[model samples]
Target: MCVISGTHGVEGFCGSGAQIALLEDAAVIAAVEKYGVAVMFYHALNPYGFSYCARTNEDNIDLNRNFRDFSRPLPVNAAYREVHDFMVPSTWPPTPENEARIGAYLSTRGEAALQAAVSGGQCDCADGLFYGGAAPAWSNGVFRDMLRRHAASRRRFAWIDFHTGLGPYGHAEKIHSGPNDAAMIARARAWYGIDVTSFHDGSSTSAVLTGVNYEAPLEECPGVECTGIALEYGTLSLLETLQALRGDAWLRNHPDADAKTRAAIKRRCRDAFYCDADDWKAMVYDQARDACLQAITQLAAAPVPH
Candidate 1:
């Protein structure tokens, strides 16, 4: 079993915290060992983003979107092209005229279109939101290597990647990330419970994305039947999360901004991704513990594939 968190950098605080908390818990460890499961913990996949409290990496690549096969044609997002300028303007906070322009676009295009355009992972713009890098990022290479080394021998693999910023506050949404076959879906639902949602089924809070991190394992270890889920915990509302992301991007673009402005942007980024409350942390830990245990139990019963 592999558990990962902090793939989004600034969003890493919640996941990293949960990983640390879970790892330290004797019960969690005992349960995994009892089930004869080997657990690999990956914390802060994007160290730069985690350290700087930004969403993207040193090159401003969204690590979650940087997992595509670069030898082939990159996935295009025409919708993202339509709203790129409006989303990230020349000025921070956006001018009133720009805001009006965005409002007009949203009124015409609708929220779903906006969500798909912004969050669907674009390869055209290197500096824009959810930009899948032109080439494999450092994190991508590291993760691929880790999969080959650690998971290649395993016949069945189960993963739970922790994330934040896209659901009801404090709720954990189990998102299916592997193949959408009925059997696979059934198995995931059985293990994680019926609350699981699949991106293919249009039931997930997330938009259909390209170059997601979870696909890396399948690409690296084709011999293994890899099953993965993104345990997305909610912090703020969608609009608020977008605002915070935009604010952080603006700060990145304008690094010379005053300390107060920078601090405020950082604070917004944190609030957008992390609840910073005891109750919220408790919910995160409980959900993670339950999910991990479920995966361990199911994998233990299944025979290892040859």
Candidate 2:
């Protein structure tokens, strides 16, 4: 079992908590022993973002979107180019005109179109949101190395990557994290259940994103039967979370801004991703535990390990 936390940096608040809980739980420990499952817990895969309370590393690269076979031609997000100016905007708090432009675009092009344009992977905009880096990042190489060392020879691997800031509050939307391969996606559904959604099929709340880090495992652990899903929990409304993200990006670009504005943006950015409530925490941890147990059960039940 491969469990990853902090892929988005700030989302690690919820994910890290869940990981700690799993580590301390006697039930979890018993299951691991019973199944003889090898568990690799990657904590804070993007440490800089986790430590600094930002979503990206020092270079402002979204680690979630930073992994890819960079030798190939990058995927072009032309729609991102169309909306980049307003989405990233020239100023914080976005001018009324900028906000209106988004509304108008959404009204005409629809919200899903706007989401795909804004959140789908893009490499041209260095400082923009969801920018897939032009090349593999340092952490990208480190992750691949970890996979090579730990998972390269595994016969059957199951991964659960924890994420936040999407879906209804406290709901763990199991998003198929692997590619569009029918077999892998089916395995994910079989293990995690049918509710596991896929962006490739437009069943996921997320956009069809590329440069996702899962490619690292597929490449590093070739021929291993793998099933992966991102357990995404909601914290805030999409617009609210998006606004927080814009402010965060703006703050990254403008370090000379006033302390008050900087503090406010930081607060909102954290709030958009992490809910500091007991109820929400319990919900997140319980769901995470349940997901881990489900994966463990499947791992134990596999008829013939390859």
Candidate 3:
């Protein structure tokens, strides 16, 4: 299964290009056919955001952050409320005073606070960026439905999710999924080696992530052996990307702002997660192809887990 990040269209230069390359690779296609592994590619899971160049979907929900069980009281990030207004200010191209306020807040609050306040998914505001929906998202529902239908026939399933804007340019990090299940970790190590990092260890760039994308299959597809990896590629540094996102959020919130200001904000957001140059595209594609091929080979060789 292909789980690609940055499917939010603007980040397409990262994993989107790589995903297409893998799909086109002659050897990769042959391997899939040989192993009888069905390919499920989730393209632009956040189509609205991708098409509009925003990280959050039309609902302003980060697809990755929207996977919580709606039945439960959603996870709350209290710190976000304080900076929500600052992120999506009422006026476009935030007034110099507003910018100074945000700078001062960041200075006093620290970078960690800024990251947490911005990245920590929220449920209270629909217009706020990175809002983790109060209920299951459209993409979330679609993915679960697909798993229910296809997972029943497959005994072994492996997933590689594509992502960007972490690490050095073109560098890929393998972040393991779910709890540190020993057998699962062993299987992943056997395929990708010792570099596999986890959220529990604080090594992964991904915040302590949750949702059904990884956990749901483990629970629902008890009959199938599943292991997943989020292949995060490097584009730009975190601080720069954060600034870009902040700028984008500000512009999105302030629609009445000048066209020039909005255009610049949108451009910054696009550049933060994607590398538009052909050389960078080639590099990301090559690495992604290698990783997917390795997974396919390992799956073909390993004995079916009982």
Count of backbone clashes, every candidate in sequence: 0, 0, 4
Which has the higher TM-score value, candidate number 1 or candidate number 3? Answer: 1
* Lowest-sum lDDT 10-residue window in model 3: 1-10
Report the lDDT tens digits of candidate 2 across residue range 1-306. 889998888899988999999999999999999989999899998888888789888788888888877788888889999988888877887899999998999889997898888788789999999888888888898999999999988888888999999899989999999889998888888888899999999999999998888888888998887788999999998889888989998998899999999999989989999999999999999999999999999988876644
Better of 1 and 2 by TM-score: 2
Could you tell me how far off, in angstroms, the CA of residue 156 lies in candidate 2 after the best superposition?
1.2
Which stretches of model 3 miss by more than 4 angstroms? 3-7, 105-109, 180-182, 256-258
lDDT: worst 10-residue window of model 1: 177-186
Tell me how far candidate 2 lies from the true structure as C-alpha RMSD in angstroms. 1.1
Candidates ranked by TM-score, best first?
A: 2, 1, 3
For candidate 3, write residues 182-242 as lDDT tens digits.
Answer: 7887777778878888766777766665543576567657778787887777888877887
Candidate 2: residue 223 lDDT (0-100): 85
Cα lDDT over the full model 1: 0.87
Clashing pairs in 3: 3-161, 4-162, 5-162, 9-50
Best by TM-score: 2
For candidate 1, write residues 1-306 as lDDT tens digits: 998877999888888888888878898889888888899998889999999988899998998888877899987899899888878777876799988987898799877788889999998887689888899899989988999999988889999998999998889999997766777777789888898999878999899988888778888888787778999999988878987888887888888999999999999998899998999999999999899888888898876766
lDDT of each: 0.87, 0.89, 0.74
